[model samples]
Target: MQHQPPARDLPASWPPERTAWLNTGAPMPLLGLGTFRLRDREAVRLSLHAALENGYRLVDTAAVYGNEAAIGSALRELLPRCGLSREDIFLTSKLSPRDHGEAPTEAACLRSLQELGCDYLDLYLIHWPGTQGHPQGDKGNKERRQLSWRALERLHESGKLRAIGVSNYTIQHLRELLASCRVPPAVLQVEFHPQLAQSELLDFCRQKGIHLQAYSSLGTGQLVGRPEVVNVAERQGRTPAQVLLRWALRQGVSVIPKSASPARVAENSQLWNWDLTHADMEELSTLDCGKRYCWDPSSVA
Candidate 1:
C-alpha cells in the first residue's frame, strides 16, 4: 500500500468483538476489502463479488485511486446478484487532496457519491492533512484543511455522510481538529502494522473515543515474510497475512487489506472465529520500531 502500504472457508458469522464502534455509535467491520490499486472495472467487480460472497460487508476506496466509478458500476450489478442492498454494505470514500476548500470539498463529496452511486456514504474522510500543490509545512495547508473540515461538518449534519473522519493525521494535526471542529472525528485511519504500531496515537484515539483503522496492515507485503510473523503463523496454522491483520484486530483496531487476487481477498475475509494469544500479541508487538511503510503525515503542518 505505499504510495506508501488471511485464511480460508472460515466462519460466516462475525463475533461480537470483531467490530469496532465509531464515536457516532456506528459499527465498522474490523476487516474489509480495500480497493487502492484495483482500478479496472472488471477487476473491481471481481474483487467486490468475491468479498461480498465471503462475508465482507465493508469496502474502502478513495478518490485519488481513480476507482470510484468502477466500484459504483460493479456494486450496482453485483449487489443484487449477491443478495444485498446498498445499506448492507458499509461504503467508504475519501475527499481528494485537490479538493481542499469549503466549496470544492462539498462538490467533490457529492461527485464521489454520484460516482459511487450512493445516496449517502457510511463513512467519509479528509484524505490528507496537507492541501496538495502546497509546501509540506505551508500555513495555507492548515487553513484549507480547516475549511475542508467545515464543509465535511455541514455534509455530516445534512446526513450525506453517515460518519466523518480524517486519515494520515498525526497527533498534532488531530489536536488542532479536535479543538476547533463542531464534530469530533469518528475515526483516525493511518499506516498501521507490527512495524509501525503508532502506540501514542492509538492511546490518544482511545482516550478521545476515535476508532483507529489500519491501512498498509501488511507493510506492503514486506513484513509478512519476517521471521517473527512467520513463526507465529506456523505455530497457529495460519497465514502470515492473517497474523498481521489479527494483530491489529486483537488490539481493538480495524483493518482494510487490499489484494488483487480474489483468492487472497477471500482469505483476508476469513478473519472471524479465531483468536491470537497473549504471547502472540507480545511477540508481534516486538516488531514495532516506528518504521512506516507508507508516506508519513508528520511532515504535514
Candidate 2:
C-alpha cells in the first residue's frame, strides 16, 4: 500500500499575520476553499475533507452554492476526527439574490445557519448587489440591497455573524451602502485575477479598510496557460495555479481557489512556504487586460 503523508500540524495562528483582520476584529484566513458550483453531495463532502485535512480552515459557501449542508456534514464528521473544533475554522456563507428584502434576508441567513448546522458564522455576505426577480435597472433593486444589508447588520449585532460583507459590489454600490451603513462592510468578495485586476476598486477597498476576498482567482483556469503566468511558474518551479494564488496573496487580497481533487487542494495550500520576487510580481501585474471570467457587476446600477 502507498504511504500517505500525515496531515500538517495546525499552526498556532493558522494563516499567520498575513491574514486580514475584519472590522469586527476577527482574523480571516487569506487562503480558503471556494465552494462555488461544488454542488454534488459526495463530491463536496470528499473535497471538504481533503481541504480540511490539508490545513484549509476557511471554507466559503453560499445559499446559491447548494452545498452548505454537504459541507456541514463533512465538518461534523471530520472535525472531531481531525482534532479541531468549530472555532478553529472560519466559516462563511452568503445570502442569495432571491433573499434580498429584510425579512427574506433574515430567513435566508437562518436557513443557511441551520443547513450548515452552525450557531454562528465567522462571516456572512450579500452574494450580489442585484436582487433576484427584479430587473437590473429597477430603482427598487437598490432598496432591496439596503434592506438585505440591514438584516446582515442585525445578524452581526446579534452575534450570529462575526463579520458581514458583500460580493461583486462595485465602487458605486459601495458608496451607496456606506452613506447609511451603521456597520461598514468588513470584507469585499469579488472576482479577481491577473486579467481582471480592478485596481481602482482594490484601492477603494484598501482605503476603506475592507479586506478584499477574491473568487475565481485563477480566472476559471484560463490564466494557467497564459505565457506570463507559465513563465513565472517555470522560474519558481511551482504549478501555474500556485503561481497565480501566490500573486494574490502577495497583493494582500484573500483568495479561495476550489478544486475537487485532493492533490490540487494540497498543492494550493503550499503558498506560505515561498516568496515571490518584485520582478516576478511586476511581470504578472502587467498581464491585466480588463478580462472578466465571471459576472460583471459594473452594469448593475
Candidate 3:
C-alpha cells in the first residue's frame, strides 16, 4: 500500500483569548469538537476525550448527527479523568426537522437533553430550516421552523437552554424569524469555509447582533490538501486546515472542526497562536469560490 502523507500538526501555543462568551453570558471555548459525521462510537469517544484533555470545553452535536448519547458517554467518562465537570464544559445540541412543531420540538429538545444526560444545554440550535433535508421539498418547512423556534424560545425562558440559535439559516429566514419571534438568536451556525466565505451573511449577523459559528471550517476535508490553501499554510509554516480555520477566526467567528482521530482532533484545537495580518487576511478572503459543500438554506426558504 502507498504510504499516506503526514497529517498537519497544531501550533505549540495559542492565545488565551481563544474563548468567547455566548449571548447568554456563558463562556465557550472558541474552538470546539464537531461531532458531525464522526461515525463510530469508539472514535467519537476517543476524539471527545482527546479534545477535553487538550483544553477544549465546547462540544457541538445535533440530533441529526445521531451521536448525542455517545457524546454524553464521552463527557461523563472523560470529564472526571480531566478533572472537569459538566459545568466546566459548554454543551450544545440541535433540534431535527422530524421534531418540528410545538409538541415535537419540545419533545426533541427533551430527548436531546436526555441523550446528553444534562439538565440544560449551553446552547440549542434549530439544526436546519427543513425537518430533514431541503426545505423546498416540504411546504411546512417555513412554518415548522418558526414553530420550532418558538418552542426553543420557551425552553430558553424556562432555563432549559441558556441560549437558542439556528443553523443553516439564510438572511431571509433570519429576517422572517426576527420579525415574528420574541428573542433574537444569539448565534447562527452555517457551513462556512474559505470555499464559501459567507461574507455577506456574516456581516448581516454581526450588524444584527447575532454571532456566527463556522461549521465545516475546513471545508469538510475539501481544503485539506488543496494547493491554494496548502501554499498559504506552507508560507505561514502552518497546516492548510489551520490556515483555513484561522481565516474564519480572524473574522471573529467561532469554529468546530470534526475529527475522530486523536492526532487530528488535537491538531484542530491549536489555532490561536498566530494572527493573520490584514494583507494575509485580504489574500485569503480572495480565495472564496462561492461554492458551498452543504445545502444552501437560501434556496429553500
Candidate 4:
C-alpha cells in the first residue's frame, strides 16, 4: 500500500491542550478533528493521520458517515507513527436512527466497533431522533430515541463504550432522557455555531452535567463569508472558521470541525492562542438567527 503524504503544513503543536473529562469521567481533547463527510477512504485516512500527527486526541465519526473503515485504517497506521497507543486516543462513533431498535442498535454498534478496528469507543451516541418516515420511528421518534439511549447504556455497562451520548437532540428530548434514563448522556452533540447559538438548550445541558459538543462549529462554510465573523476574524488575526470555533470554546463547549484540506485542518486547531473578550463573545451571541443548516427534527412530529 502506498502511503499518503502528511496533510497539514503546520508545526507539531496544533491544539496545544490537554484532554477534557466528560460527566462520565472519560477524557477527550477539547478540540477534535471531525470526520463527518470525508467519505473517501484514502482522504479520511490521510486527514486522520494529519490530525493525530498534529495533536488531536479525540476523533469523531459515525456509522452513518460511512468512513469508519478509513478512520480505522488511519488509527492503525497513524497511532504507530505518532508513537501513541489506543489508550492515548479518544474515539467516538454514533448509531444511526435506522438502528434504533435494541437488536439492530446492538448490531450496528458492534459493526462500528469492528469497522473502526478499536477495542471500545470512548463515546457512542444516538445519531438523531428518527426521521418522520423512517422505519426506526414508526411509533414515535422520541420514544425510539429513548430506547436507543437505553441500548447505549447497555453497551456502556458491558464496557463496549466508555460513555454514551446523543446528537442533534433538543432540550425536550434531553429532559425526557434525563428524567427516565438509568445513566444520563455524558455529551450532547449538536449543530451549533454563532448563527445557531442554541443558548437555552446549551444552558440546560450545562446545568444537567452534560457536555455540549459543538458540531459544524463553522456553520458548514456559512461563516466563511459572514460579515460579523469576518470582522471578528480580522480583529483577531485569524480565519473566520477559527473565530467561530473560538466562540464555541469560549462558551465552554467542545468542538469538532471537519476539514479535508490540510490548511483548514491545521487552521481549525489553531484557536487556543487568543482569547475572545467578553464583548467579542457578547457580539457574536447576537448573530444567532436560529438558522439550522441541517434538518429540524422537531418538524417531524
Candidate 5:
C-alpha cells in the first residue's frame, strides 16, 4: 500500500494568519468567498473586489453554479486592479454531478478550466457522490464516483488540478473512496454549521489528513438570528454571521460563506485576529441537534 501524509489535527498555524499548509503542501487561506448563486457579472466584480481587498485568497465555484464565466471575467478585470496575479490566488471549481463516470468527468474538468479561463485549477472537487437524476440509493452511484475519482486523480497528476477533493460526501461515501483512491482527498466540503455540526465526519477527516471545509455555516442564513447565536455575537461584539462563522474556525474547519453584498463579503473575511471564548464555543456546540439546511448526502448509496 502506498503511504500518504499523516493527519495533523489542527492547522499548523492554529490562529491562522495569511495561509495554512494543506495536506497537498499548498497554502490555503483561512476564509474564502463562496460564489454559489452569485452569477451577475457586476455583482461578481464588486464582491471579488471586496473579497480580495479584505485578504481573501480563495474563491470557490462549481460548473453547475453557472457563474464560472462571469467569475473568470471578473478576476481578469479585478486581480490586476488588486495588484495580484493568477499565482497569488487559489482558484477552486468542482466536477458536476451530471458528469459522473471517467470520460465525462475528465471532459467536464477541462471545460471548467476553459470557462474559468485558467490553465489549471488550484483545487477541483466531485460536486456530489451521486450521479445527476439518479436516486440517492442507486447502486451505480458508488461505481460512478469511483470512476470520477479516477478522472480527478489523473487531472491532479497532470497538474491541471493542483488538489482534488469531494463535496457533499457522507462518512460512507468517503470511506468508499478512501479504500481505493490513489490520491487521497485533500478536502471535504459540506454543509457544516452549529446545527449540523457533523462531528463524526470532522473527526474522520482529521484522522485521515483530509481538511473539512464548511459551507452554509449559518444554516443558509437561518441560524444568524437565532437567540443562541445572536447572544454569542452580542457578547462578542460581532455580527451574528461573524459569530457563526467563527464557531467553525475555532473547531479547525475552513469556511466559505457566500454573499453578494460588498460589505457582507468584507465582513465574512474578518474572521482572522479574533478568538471566540470557550463559553461561546461550547454554547454553539449545543446547537448541534443534527439539523441540516442544505442537501443531505446520507441518502446516497
Candidate 6:
C-alpha cells in the first residue's frame, strides 16, 4: 500500500520545510539541482552559483556526468560568499557502471571525493544495476552488482557516505538486492514524472522505508508543453514546471530538476508555499503512459 501523509494547511512563506528524513535520520532537501550532461565548466560554475543563490541546498551529480570538479569549484567559490558551510548543503554523486566491481567501486568513490575536494559524500548511489563492459546476459552481472553494493556498505560504515542507495533499479532488482544486502538502501533515484508514475515501485519503496527520489521530474521539457499540465498551471497560478514538481511532491517523493538557466533554476525552487487541488492531482495522475525521458532500465535483468 502507498503511504500518504495527511495534508496540512499551506504556508505563508517562500521556503517551507521541504525536507525528508532518510533512514539514517538525516534530513534531505526534497528539491535539488541535478547536474547531468552539463559539460561546460564555466556554464556549470555560473549555474551552480545561481542555484545556491536561489536557495538550493541539495546538489546532485554523477561520475558519468563528468562535472563533479566543476561543481566542486563552484561550491568552493560560492559557499563562503553565501554564508554556508559544507554541512549545510547536501551533496550526492553516483558510481559509474564502468566501475562496478568491489575494488573499482571503492577506488571510484575515493576518486570522486578527491575530485570534489570533499571528505565524504552526503549520499552515493549505484548508477545502474548492469555493468558497463559486461553484456546484459552475462552471468557475472548480478555478482558484480552485489560486490559493488558490498563496497558501498563498507563506505557507509566508514562514514564516507552518510547514506547509500541505487538508481534505475526496478522491482526485481531491488528485491534481489534487499535479499542479500546487509544495509538497506536509504534512497532510490529513478526517472519519474506525471507521464511515468511507476506507482507499484513507489508503493514498494514507501513500505520498505526507502525514500523515493524522482529525476527528470519535468519530463525533459516535454511535460511543460502538455495541455493537462498547462491547464493546471493556469488554474493554480503556477508555472507548468512547478505544477509537475508539486505533483511529484504530493506523491511523497523527492524531485531533482536540472536547468542551466539562472531564471529557470530560481523558478523551479519556488515549489514551496503552495499546492494543487485534488481534482488537479487526479487529472495529472491520469496522464501517466509510461513515458521515459531518460534511459530505460527495465530490461537490465
Per-candidate TM vs. native?
A: 0.94, 0.95, 0.91, 0.91, 0.94, 0.94
Question: 192-241, model 2: which lDDT tens digit per residue?
Answer: 98888888999998888788988998999989999999999999999999
Candidate 5 regions exceeding 4 Å error are 1-16
lDDT of 4 at 111: 98
Which of 3 and 5 is ahead in lDDT? Answer: 5
lDDT of 4 by residue, 1-301 (tens): 0112322222333333444557765556788889888999878877787777667778999988999998888788888888888877878999986787777888999999999998799899988877434654355776777777778889999999988988887887787788889998888899998889988998898788788899888777877788877887788888888888888888788889888887678767787768888877877878889988876766433
Q: Give a tens-digit lDDT track for model 3, residues 77-179.
A: 8888888877777789998867889889999999999998999998999988876644476677888888998899999999999889999999988998999
Measured on C-alpha atoms, candidate 1 has an lDDT of: 0.87
| Candidate scoring better on TM-score of 1 and 4 | 1
Per-model clash counts, in order, read: 4, 0, 1, 0, 0, 0
Clashing residue pairs in candidate 4 (N, C-alpha, C atoms within 3 angstroms): none
- Model 5 per-residue lDDT tens digits across residues 7-88: 3332332234545567887767668899999988898889989998888888999999999999999999998998888877
Worst 10 residues of 6 by lDDT: 6-15
RMSD of each: 5.5, 6.1, 7.8, 6.9, 3.7, 3.9
Which runs of model 3 end up more than 4 angstroms from their true locations?
1-16, 133-139
Error of 5 at 250 (Å): 0.9
The pairs that clash in candidate 3 are 97-131
Q: Which 10 successive residues of model 2 have the least lDDT summed?
A: 1-10
- TM-score of predicted structure 1: 0.94
lDDT of 1 by residue, 23-84 (tens): 77666667788999889888889888889888888899999999999999999999899878
Clashing pairs in 6: none
- Which candidate, 4 or 6, has the higher TM-score? 6
**Angstrom error at residue 195, model 5:** 0.4
